[model samples]
Target chain A: MNKKIKQNIAFFVFRLFSLLIVGVLISILGFIAINGIQVIDWEFLTTAPKEGMTEGGIFPAIVGTFYLVVGSLIFAVPLGVMSAIYTVEYAGNGRIVRFIRMMTNNLASIPSIVFGLFGMALFVNKLGFGDSIIAGSLTLGLLTLPIIIRTSEEALKAVPESYRTGSYALGAGKLQTIRKVILPSAMPNILTGIILSVGRVSGETAPILFTVAAYFLPSLPDSIFSQAMALPYHLYVLATSGTDVEASRPIAYGTALVLIMIVLFFNLLAAFLRQRLNKKLKQH
Target chain B: MIETKNINFYYGDFHAIKNISMKMEPNTVTAFIGPSGCGKSTFLRLFNRMNDLINNTRLEGECLIKSKNIYDKSIDVDELRKDVGMVFQKPNPFPKSIFENVAYGLKVNGVKDKKFIAQKVEESLMAAALWDEVKDKLHKSAFELSGGQQQRLCIARALAVAPSVLLMDEPASALDPISTSKIEELIHQLKSNYTIVIVTHNMQQAARVSDKTGFFMMGELVEYSDTKKMFLNPDKETTQNYITGRFG
Candidate 1:
């Protein structure tokens, strides 16, 4: 065959491979929707599970997941954003800075199970928190810290240097410049990073499994020290370790569907925020 | 008045500005003319310490304004910057409304009175000769303005803080001839109030706007004299050649 024909065939193969990945994603989504859509209802969402983990809803799990996400973000976002600003804006390229950056990158690649073990040892046992919401939240926060810091640093770096120079030349101090100019410019990207971390924290089961996940909690958690039922762990228990795995299959699919929907909702919210904030920035 | 005494500058041991000395009178326009990489722009930035933002840059010799050394540790850099405003070659209006762009300097200085900020913004815009065109659209984004208008907006921004000195680093180099002439006209009008130092590659522009002219080449001051004499009867052979279009 000639070169042009060979190139066309190669391009066709690449396109097919790309479509295959999308096809797989759609197939999985379709399978879950078919199996899980029937079991979803308002009552199912607002009430606790009934009759030996086979009947009612995943309400406690939903509430527990919400609390966990909020708790993690409260612990992580400020610390992550501030650390990013320090690295990107204040810290010069010195040995310590390089070492910190290297450590963060390494942390990002560690397996989720390893993070769970670390969390179990540090927050759960050593801190005497036991299997509690705070332990789980802190663990998830640790799991997501590297991601948030890296993304936030990228966002901060994306702001043009001209803006900083302009602010400084106008006699604005470093803090004022960051608060008024740099933060505003980087807000949308930081929000994006937070949304991504929310997705990761919500879907993660291994980290919460060792740190805080309860086998079956039908009621709402009253305090940070209470063991919680997160969606991922709930789904995992319903599928694998339930008294009747065959009967609990629908509930398992329902939990998975709700988790996916929650993630999708947050992603949509992030997209909306990005659009609004970008418009505001441009309007100036 | 501004004076530099035997100033030598380096970028990490690469001597970028050789020993150069010059004096500038207050409320007069002094222009530096040089080819690219000749350190004319670098010299202009030294007035406001803009070069301090770059790393590994060092300066020797006193840069005094109004008989006070600005680079002294005792002097506040922010206060010094407020006293000395700078406009760059490119029109860098912040991504803010035209009104905010002009009012930025005053606001940063803790000026919270709304009426005062409004009045100062107007006065600065008027001084920059951009008030009439933008008066009706002050709330609009600064990016919406034409390049020339944006350049004038930046000038107005610099003027808002009421600085005694204004440094223009090839202010009109990026502009069209018509915009360039408008800027030149504004510079002429501004000289009655602020000390103006401009760097330009356009020799004609230097002659048109400046009262005194300094020629720089290869990071050294080649000639310094009154603009009329510098253009008419240059003392140095190199200055003569440069003016007569022999070489940069």
Candidate 2:
């Protein structure tokens, strides 16, 4: 009715929406923790499924997910950081650089299911790796590549222009300037990008679904060629397609909780790393 | 010695530096005083080829240092820069220790002996008049120093490469009066070994530290002469007006 009332109403609406998001997040976490906490123990975390996906911990799946994450990071981190350095530093702001940026953004927007299918055709079938850890990792790496590149580019760009000029003024070449000054300055933000990619790569089910995920694996994957049970896919099978979905519901919830915890751990690690790097860069 | 013969520079389509000629003798301090956007800083940067870092910039005419045309295709830019060091308006030390900031030049130029680098760092800092303040904390971060100290650190960084020429682009504009005086004193002391060219907005600073003075306006060098002659009895009316603070 009046300006004060209108402003108050707008503030109330915005506050309500923000609180609603927190409420939804808490309810989801609360639901999973309450349902799965009783089932989780050292044995549940360390042993394989025992009775047709109805008992025992999702140990093989957890190990498989861990391996897949490490493999993807190995494949993606260097490639992504290098690509970002090229696009941001070497390429200059030209038509080709603009095109590369556009393509990266487009790649980020592409469906994860499309990546899964592509991985199946390329790494799994054409490359003849079949359903294996390598294929799955390569797929997940592709899925995370755009994220890493974009974030790394931002990190590199955030470095002050004065640093580049300062390095150049001291008779340093471009490569030397980048190596000695730019990279160290941008390292914190670049590491943040890598950690964020790790979080996203861990929870993704689609890209790894056709490439390496197994409906049931008796043991952990021994090599890159072996098919492995992954947490997201294991949870999917337990909740939706297992022989007794109701019987495996608690295990499915536990798997979801573990996946969430892994993501949370990485997020915390990113924050911790950023703080440490900022302090080190600012002080010693 | 540094000389520019009728040099003109363009930033894309805009003429940023009109035809200008000047000579700076070895071991003498020459100051360019001008209003903002007068291209004094741009003209100063030409000696080190620092302007080349900007995109779509064009230069015509010759820029020479020590009788050799630095603008020649045969000249290696990195080598040119090694001989012509530049200090910027803002003190830009890398995110590194005080010692490392000074040693950066030597490290990048492939100087490997740790003992030699350490020696050079101390000498450069001493020359910059910052060694006594930071000598106890060489390994400490450069950001911990005061702004004036940081500016001196930048000068130390520039001097560490053993350049024969030094370019100061308003090196004391961002500092307090005490720091400004310290930098000006440092400039005076440094003139015996390095040919220094400084661009200053502060006219008194130009008169105090320079052997020669050049007044620039609208991308043109309006007057160039001995500092005393230029300040007391300028040959041009515009120079007189600018020096006397009649107008920029």
Candidate 3:
């Protein structure tokens, strides 16, 4: 075949694959929306389950998932951002830095089921927290920690080198330079890391399965130590293991749609915040 | 006011600056002119120790400013930098407002009196010949200014710390001819208050702005003398060929 014909065929294949993924995503969303939209009244959203997990809304699971997301972020963001600053800024490319980077990469690739088991062994049983929000959050936090660290490191590194040199030339110390110049410049990008972690922590079922998820809870969690009904785990039980699986299928679809919406909400919030920060940096 | 004694610098195993000794008088404009990669900019950075930021770089010999060894173990590098300020090849204004850009040096040095900072910012801007252009929009972003104006803002930022020595590493090389002339004129006016050292690829720029001139070639200072004598009657044949546009 001629080069032009070969190039045309390659381009067509690439376009087909890209559109294929988009088609798959749209079909899944359409399936869930069509099957779930009828069950999504205000009463369905705000009330507890009725008739043995067959009727009513998954309010407690919604709140529980929300709590887990917030808790995980509270646990991971500070630790991850600080670690990234230390590794990317203060730590030169020495043996220790390389070792730390290697360990982080290894941690990122570990299966979420392993994190679930580790959390059960450490937070749930050994530490005696038992299947509670705190334990589950810590587990999910660990799962997302490597992602945050990698992203924050990239964000810090993305800042122009001239800013650091400019600050130092003005006689600013390392800490001051980072706090005043580097951190402000890297804030928008670091927020992207936080956004990504929120999405990951919210949708995860395995890590929370053995740590914090409840099979059936009618009320919202009263404290951090209380067993919580998370959306993903609740959906899993309703769709797969529950006695009234066919009856609760619509509720499970609704729960999946709500989870996706929550993730989308947080992503939109973060994108808005990034825009404001960039504008603030530019205007004043 | 500035002196180096047999300075030798290396980037790993590759020697960048050979043994070179020179003295610059206080309150005079001294220009170092050379081709690219001739170590003129590297030698200029030695005054402020900007090269310390790079890794695996080695320096041998004493760099003294005001008769104090800046490279001594006891010296505080930040403190030394405050006494010697440098402007870079490209204008690097922080992503901040015009007022904040000039106030950065003072704020970093722990000056908290808002009134004093405001006054110093004004004075520094005036000294850099930028106050007339940007006085009305102090709160606007520094990026809003033109390239020439931003370079002057950087100079104003350096002057806010009250350094006695100013170093310019090809400050006008990236600018247009009109802006270059403006920077050259600013350097002439700034000589009485600060010891100025500049590195330029333009030999005519050195002749026009420098009181003393140093010609560097392949990591060596081939000649150092009064600007008129170096350009009019160079001591070395190479310097003569270079100044007369014969050397490649």
What is the lDDT for A46 in model 1? Answer: 91
lDDT of all the models against the reference? 0.92, 0.94, 0.93
Q: Once superposed on the true structure, which residue ranges of model 3 sit more than 4 Å away at CA?
A: A1-15
lDDT of 3: 0.93
DockQ for every model comes to: 0.72, 0.86, 0.75
Clash pairs (backbone) in predicted model 2:
none
Which run of 10 residues does model 1 chain A get worst, by summed lDDT?
A275-284
Residue lDDT tens for model 3, A1-284: 99999999999999999999999999999998888887898988898888988898889999999999999999999999999999989998999989989999999999999999999999999999999999999999999999999999999999999889888888888998999889998998999999999999989999999999999887889999999999889889999987799999988889888888888999999999989999998888
| Candidate rank order under DockQ | 2, 3, 1
Chain A TM-score, structure 3: 0.96
Cα misplacement distance, residue B38 of candidate 2 (Å):
1.4
Candidate 1 similarity to native, TM-score: 0.97
Q: What DockQ score does model 1 reach against the true complex?
A: 0.72
Question: Best TM-score goes to which candidate?
Answer: 2
**Model 1 agreement with the true structure over B86-144: per-residue lDDT tens digits:** 89888888878999999989988999999999999999999999999999999988989
